[model samples]
Target chain A: MDSARDEPVLDVRGLRVEYRGDGRSVVGADDVSFSIGAGEVFGLAGESGCGKSTIANAVMRLLKPPAEITAGSIRFQGRDVLALDGRELRAFRWREIAMVFQSAMNSLNPVLTIGEQIGDIFTTHEKLKKRAARERAGELLELVGIDPGRLKAYPHQLSGGMRQRVVIAMAVALRPRLLIMDEPTTALDVVVQQEIMAQIRDLQRELGFSILFITHDMSLMVELSDRMGVMYGGRIVELANAKDLFAKPLHPYTEALMNAFPPLTGPRRELTGLFDAPRTADSCGFHVRCPDDRSDCSANIPDLREVAPGRWVAQSAQGAP
Target chain B: MTHPLLSVRGLTKDFQVGTVFSRRRVRAVDDVSFDLPAGRITALVGESGSGKSTIARCLARLEQPSAGQVLLDGEDVLRTERRRASQVYRRKVQMVFQDPFGSLNPVHRIEHFLARALVVHGHPATGEALRELMTTVGLTEDMLQSYPHELSGGQRQRVAIARALAVRPRLILADEPTSMLDVSVRVGVLNLMRRLREERDIAMLYITHDLGSARYLADTTMVMFAGELVEGGDALAVMDAPAHPYTRLLLSAVPDPERAGSYDPVERARLREAILNPTSCPYGDDGTCSRTEPVRHIVGEDDGQPHWVRCHLRAPASDIARRVLKATDDTEKAETTAA
Candidate 1:
C-alpha cells in the first residue's frame, strides 16, 4: 500500500445529500467527510438507508434530481469532481474513478459477450480499435482469475462470481486510480465471496488503486479496509484505522453494529438488535438506540472529533483516549 | 429418549430442465435426511443450490419429494395423506418464507392475513386473539391494523411469524427468514424465533447460508453441500471444531474479526476446486465418491449427542453399502424404540 499522506486519491468534505420532495427535504447524507489515501482501502459501513450508498453516489456524481448534493466537495487527486462537465465527467468516471455497484453482476447486458463488454470500456474511453480492445479484454479477464477463453461467453453463461469478475474487469479497464465497490460480494456465496475479496486484494496490490469499499458487513469491512467510517442516521459517527475500529469501537452504534451478528466461534451470548429510530437534530442521532445514552445526550449533538491520532469518535463525553 | 417431531428419510427432489425433447432429471435434493426434535432448532446451513431450502419445502408439503418418507410424530404423512397434505398436517407444519414483502399481501392489512390463517385453522378471529398473536411475536396491537408496506422489513417478518403462529403449528420451517432483512434488524427476528421455541416448544428447521446466525439460534447445526448432508452436530461444538472438510472450508470462508488479514487465497482456491466437483471426493479422487454413498461416521459425542460426518475421508473404506444399510437399520431401530 503505497499511501502518500499529503495527496489522497479521493477526498470528500462536508458532503450532504438530501432527497427533496413534497416541499420537504430529508438528509440522506449529512456533513460527511473522509479521504482515501493513495493505494489505500477506505470503507464506509452502515445498514440500509444510513446514507453510506448516498455518499458513494455523491462521490461518483451519480446523484440525480430529488437526490441533490446540498453541500460539500469531492476532490479526486486535487481535481474537483463536482465541477466536471458533461464530457469531462464522462471522461472522469471510468478513466479516473470507477464504481462497482451492489448488483453490478446483474447490471451486465445479456446480449453482449464478456469480451465485448470489457472491450467497450476501452473503445469508448481509450479510443482503442475494436481488435486491440478485445485483446486487452482477454488480459483483464485473466487478471481477475477467469479463463481468457470465456471472453466469448455471454453474461448469463457465467456464474454469479464470474459475472462480478467481468464487472470488475470492466471497472478497471482504464486503470482508474479509485475503485468504488458498493457491497460487491454481498449476494455471493461465502466461499465465492472470500475468493472475490482475495482477488480484489491481489488486484489492488498489483494495480495500486485506492478502493472505497462500502458494505453493512462490519467484519468484512474491518478485514478489507485500512481505515473506515461508521455511519448512523446519515452521519459519520466514527472513523479510525480498521483494526482499531474493530478492537475497540468508541461509538455506541458502531459497537452495536459489530455485535449485531453472532460470532462464528464463540460462547453463546445475547445479541443486541438495534431498533429503528428517527435522528434527532438537537441531540445525538444514535441516542435513541444507544445503550450508554445519558440524559445530556438529548440536549447536545455529538461531533466527530479526533480523540486520538487516528481514531475519531462522535460522543458528548467520556470518549477520552 | 423422545421421538423426533419430524423425521425425513431418503428425501429427494428432481426437476426437469431444458426443452421437452431434451428433458432430463436434475436432482435438486438427493437422499437428504434429518430429524427435527420437539422444541429444538435444527439449522440446515448451505449455500445456493445446496438443497437446504428444498428440504424445508419438502417438509412443509409445498414441494412433493420424488422419493422419501416424511414421518411426523411417528406417522408417515407422505404415505397416509398422498397427493395433498391434510388440513391437520398443514396446521401442524407451517412455513415462513424468505421474502416477507413478497409473502404477504400488500393490498391487505396485517390483521386480515393473521385472521385468515386463524379462521382456516379453527382459531378465534377475535381482536383479543389477533392481539395475542401480535404480542407473541413482540409486535404491538396497532400494528395488526397496518398494511404490510406500512411496517418495516423486520416488523413485516414478525407479522409473517405471527401469521405462521396463528395456525398453532408444532413445527416451523423458516427458509432464510432474515436474509432479506437489514443487518440491524435481523437479530430481532432471530431472537423472536428463539422465544417461540422456548415458550411454545415449536420445533424449527432454519435454512440459511449464514453460519454465524445458524450457530447463534440453532441447537443442532447441519451443513449441506451439493444436496448432501456433509456434517451435523451440536451448534457450538461443530462451529468450534468442524469435522468435515467442507464444513471447515465453509467456516474458513466466514469473515471473522479475529482472523482478519489471514486469508490464504492459494488454500481457499484448492479447497474450492476440490469441494466444487460434487461427483468426486474432496480428499482424493479414488472413485469412491462417485461409486458409493459415504457412510456417516461418528466423530465426537457429548452425553450421547453425537457429532456425525458424511465423508469418505472420515469413514473407513470398508463395505460402504453394508455400512450404510446397517446405519439405516440402527437409526430405524433407535427411532422405533423411541416411538
Candidate 2:
C-alpha cells in the first residue's frame, strides 16, 4: 500500500479548457486543480455540460478541435502530460492511464467478441501474440469475476452488467496508474451496478491503482470514493472526504445537489430544488440558484481555498476559504 | 369501496426470437397480476428484460398479451371486441415512454403534435383545452410554438406528460420516463409526477430500474425478476426490508454512497443467471423450489397493504410460511378487502 504514498499519481494545476467556434466561446473547465493519491478512489461529481467529463477528456488528451485546453499543466508521476504528443501520447494512454468512457458498456463493438476486444489492448500495448493476448484477456475476465469461457461471447451476447465488466477488465488489463471511469455503471440496473462497483473496488484494493471515478450520482460516489470533488458550472466548487461532503457541503451548489435526490431508507422530506443557474452578469456562477444568495456573494467568483487540513470549499460568503 | 381503476390477472407475454426454423420463446412477462387503484402509485421495478415494460405495454394496449385479462371498471378490456368499449378503454390508459426525444415527432411543432393527439383520441382540440393541458404540466405559451428539438430534455419530457394528460387518462403507465434525463432534472420530473397524482387523482404504474426513484414516488412497490413479481408490499417497508431472495439481492445491489456493503462472492458469480437464466429457484437451484412456472406466496396482510413474495421457496405447504402468512392477517380481514 505504501508503494507510492509521498508522490501523487496525478497532479492537475490551474487547468482551463474552452469550447470556441462560430463567434461563441464557452468555458469547458475553469482553472480546476486536483490530485489523486496512489490507490485512492477520487470521485468527480457533476451534471451534464458541467465540465467534469471535459476535464477527464483533457487529462486523457482526447480533446478535439473547437475544444482546446486553453491553459493548464497536467503532470503524471511528475512528468508533464500536456507536453506529450505523437508516439509518447500513445504510450501514455493505456500503459500509463487508461480510461472507461461515458457509457463505455454500450460503446463496445457489437460485432467483436468480448475477449477479442480486450485482447486487442494487450496485443497493441504489450505486443503480445494473438493467442497470448487472448490468454491474457481470459485472465483479465476471470480477474473481473466473469467466466473465462465467455471470452468467445460477442458484445450483444453478454448482459449490460457483463458488458460493463468487460470494459473495466480491459481498462485495468495494463494495470495503469490511474483509471478514469466516467459514469461506468449508469446504464446498468441497481443490483448489477452495486456488483460492478464492488468488483472495481475489490480490483482497486488488490492491484493498488488510483482511480478518477466520474459520475453525477452522489450516492454511488459516496459508496465507492475515498474523497470527492464536486463540480458546478465548469469549476470544482468543493473538495473533501466523502463523509464530510455528504454530511455538510460548504458550497451552495454542493448543498443544493445533496438535496436534489431523495434518500431511499430515510424519513421522507421535501426537496424544493430551489434556485436557478447564476446569471451571466453574476460573478459567482451559482448565485442565481443559491437560496442564501447575498449582494456580496454575487460580487466575485470565490477561490478554492483549504478550509481545514484536507477539506476545501469555494464560497465567497465563507470569507477567504 | 370503489372497484380498482385497473386490474391485471395472470398477465403474460412471450416474444419469438432466433431463426424461424429454430425459434425460441422468450417469456418476457410471466404470470404477473396486480391492481392499480385510483390515486395510488404502484411501481414496477426491475432490470432490463424483467418484463415490467411488457406488463405496462399490455396495460396500455400497445402490445397484445399472450394470456391475461386487463379489467378496467370490471370490464375485460383485453377480451372486449366492440369498438366503443375498446375506445373507452384506450381513453382510460395513457403511456409515456423512456426517450422524450424519440417519442416526439421531429417534423412537427410542440403545439401541433399535442393538439393532434387530442383530435385523434376524440378529445377537445380547442385552444383552451391545449392551454389548460400545457399549464397542468408546467409549460407556458412560448414553449408550445417551439419544436421538440428546440426544447431541453426536461421540457420535452414535460411535453410528453402533457400529451398523456391531454386525454385525461385515469391511469398513466410511465416506462422509464426519467432515466435519460440529467441527474438534476430527474428529481424535478419525479416531483412533477408526484404533484400530478394529487392534482389529477390518477393511478400510475411507474416502470423503472432505479429503486431510489421508485421509493420516492411509489406508495406500493412491486419487485419483478425474470419476468415474475418476486415481491410486493408498501414501498417503504419493501425497500427497507425486502423479504424475497431476489428482492433482497436487488435492494443490496443499489450502490449507496454511504454504505459500500459487502458483496456476496457466490451471488456475484451467479449474477447473470439471477437476471437472465429464465428458470431456476432464486434461493437455490432445487427440484422443490424450482417449479415449472413462477409462483406467488401470500406472505401476509398488514395495514392497508398486504405483503406478498412470489417465490416457490416460501410455498403455502410450509408450516413456517403458513405461520408467517397467518400472523399478518386473519381470514376476516383478507375477505373484507379481497376485491
Candidate 3:
C-alpha cells in the first residue's frame, strides 16, 4: 500500500471516449479515472463493451477512426500525453510505454520469423547492428522462459501459448517503465492463462515496472492485481485495493459482478447478474440492472468518491464517512 | 439406475489427417462410454482436444461414429436406416453449440428461426407455439420481430435454446454453451438449462472445460483427458476430491480469489504440456500404463452407488492402502457436508 502513495507512473483523469458514426453513437467511456503507481499492478475489470479496452486504446493513442477521446488528461511522468505533437508522441508511444495486445494470433506478423519481428524493433528504434539486434531478441525470448533456439521458427510453427509468450517478450524488449496489457490471456486456456500471468508478474517484479492490466475476468484480476477498478456501462463504479474490493464490494454493480462467478470453495449459491437490458448513458449506467437501485439512482450520475481510507465507490448511497 | 435415457456404448471417432497417401489416423473420441440418466445433467469436463465435443456431435449424428452405438431405449441409433426413423431420432435429440453469435441465422427473425425448427420436426409453426418457446426461455414476444444481430449475446443463446426445445428433444447436447458468454450473463443461461431439466425432465450432456460451472449446474461430473473417461461420480464428490491428476489440474486452474496463492508457476508449465497420446496416462505412462491400457476400478460404493475412476495408480483392493484411501474419502465427505 505504501507504494501507491509514491509518484504514479501513469495518471489518468476525467477520461471520456466516444464512438461516433452517421446516426448511431456510443459513449465508450465516461469520466473514467485511475492511476498506476510505480511497480504496481492496476487492474481495470469489466464485462464486454464496458470500455476497459477503450481505455487501453486511449492510453496508447491507438483509437481507430470514429472512436475518439473526447475529454481527458493522461499524464506520464507529469507530461501531458494528449498535448504532445507528432514526433514527441511517436517517441513516447513505445519507448516510454509498451502495449501487449489482446489477441496474440493477430498481433504477431505471420510472414516474419520470431527473431526478425522482434529484432526489427531494436533495429529501427535503437539503430543497433544486425548481429546485436538478433542477440537482444534472443535475450528477450530467454526472459520469457522460451528457448532462444526457437527464434528462427515462424509463428505458425509455434503453438497458441508460445505465440503469446513471443508477444510478451516483444512488449518488454525495450524495458519500458510502464506496460499496458489488454486481456493478454483472454484467448488462452485456463492452465496456459495462469502460466502467462505468472510469467508477466515475474517480469514486472524483476524489472520494477508498473503495469495496467485490463481484462473482463474478475477473479483473475483480483488474484493478480494490487488494486482494481470495476467498470460498468462505460463508468467506473468502484475502486479499491484488490483484496478489499473482493471482501466487501460497496457498489451494487460490483456486488452483482462478484456473485456472477460460481464459487470454487464456498457453498453453491445461484448467481444473480443483471436481469434487464443495459441502461442508457443519461442515467446511472447500471440503474436498470441493479437489484437495489432506487428512484434517486437515476436522478443524477454518481461521482466516484472516496468512501474509506483507501476505498472508493460511485453510488448514491455511499460516500466518504 | 432406472434405464439410462441415452446410453453410449464404446463410441469412437477417428479423422484422417495429412495427405491421402501419407494419411495418419487421429482418434478424436476413443472408446468413450457414458449414460445420460433420465433428466440429469451429465457434464463431460475436459481440456481442448479431449473429445468432449466429438461425443456431443456423435449423439446428434452430426458425424458418423467409426464404431459402437448410441442406444435409446435399447435400440441402436446407427442401425436404424430408414429416413423417417432418423428424423424421429433427430427430433428426440438436438444440440446447442458454443458460439451464440454464429449459431443463429443473421438474416432471420427470431420468429422465423423458432418456426422453422417446429416445421422441420413436423409440428405446426404457429404464432402460439413461437410465443410459448420464447416465454419458456424468458424472452418477450416483441423480440420475435428482431433479427439475431439485434439481441444481446445472452438473448441470442436463449433463442438458440428455444429453437432446440421447439423439437421437444428427449436429450439436449449443449457443447460449451456458456463459454462465449460474459461471466455476468453466463449464470442466467445455466439457470435456464437447469430449469429445463427439472421442469421438462430433458436429459442434458454439458460439454465444457470449466469445472466450476459443472459442479453448480450438473448432477454428475465425468472427467475426460486425452479422449478417455478418467473419473466420474456425483458432481460434489468429483469436485471435492478429484481422484485423477488431470481432473485436479483442471479444477486448480479455475480462477478463485480464495485459492489465489496455491498456483505454482513450475507446476503450471509442467501441466501446460498435457497428455496427447491416446493410449498413455497423462501423468506419466510408466511401463504398464503405456502397454496395458487401464480399466475402470470401482472404488467406493455406499448405499448401492459407485465412485468410478480410471487410474493406474490407485486400484480398489481389500488391503491396508485401500482402507487408508477410504478413510480420507470419508473425511472429505464430512468436510463437504459441514461446508
Tens digit per residue, CA lDDT, model 3, A1-321: 465457788999999999998988888998999988888899998888889999998888888879988898999878888888888977887788999888865778889999999999999899999899999999999999999999999998887888999998888888888899998887676767777887887898898888999987789999989999999778888999999998888887778777777766667777775544565746655666655645566744577878788898886654321
Model 1 DockQ (Cα-based): 0.68
TM of chain B vs. native, candidate 1: 0.88
Task: Answer with 1 or 2, whichever has the higher DockQ.
Answer: 1
Tell me the tens digit of each residue's lDDT in model 3 across B257-321.
Answer: 78875666555335434444324444654323444455687766533446688765666443323
Worst 10 residues of 2 chain A by lDDT: A273-282
Error of 2 at B303 (Å): 5.1
TM-score of each: 0.90, 0.90, 0.88
Residue-wise lDDT of candidate 2 within A259-318, one digit each (tens)?
A: 776677787666766344442534655675666644456755566778888998876544
Q: List each candidate's DockQ score.
A: 0.68, 0.56, 0.55
Question: Docking quality tier of candidate 3?
Answer: medium
Candidates sorted on lDDT, descending = 1, 3, 2
Q: What's the residue-level lDDT of B14 in candidate 1? A: 92
Report the lDDT tens digits of candidate 1 across residue range A114-152: 888888888988899999999999999999989999999
Query: Which pairs clash in the backbone of model 2?
Result: A219-B257, A222-B257, A223-B257
Q: What's the i-RMS for candidate 2 in angstroms?
A: 2.1
- What's the C-alpha lDDT at position A305 in model 1? 85
Candidate 1 residue pairs in backbone clash: none
Cα error, candidate 2, residue B287 (Å): 8.5
> In terms of TM-score, which candidate is stronger, 2 or 3?
2
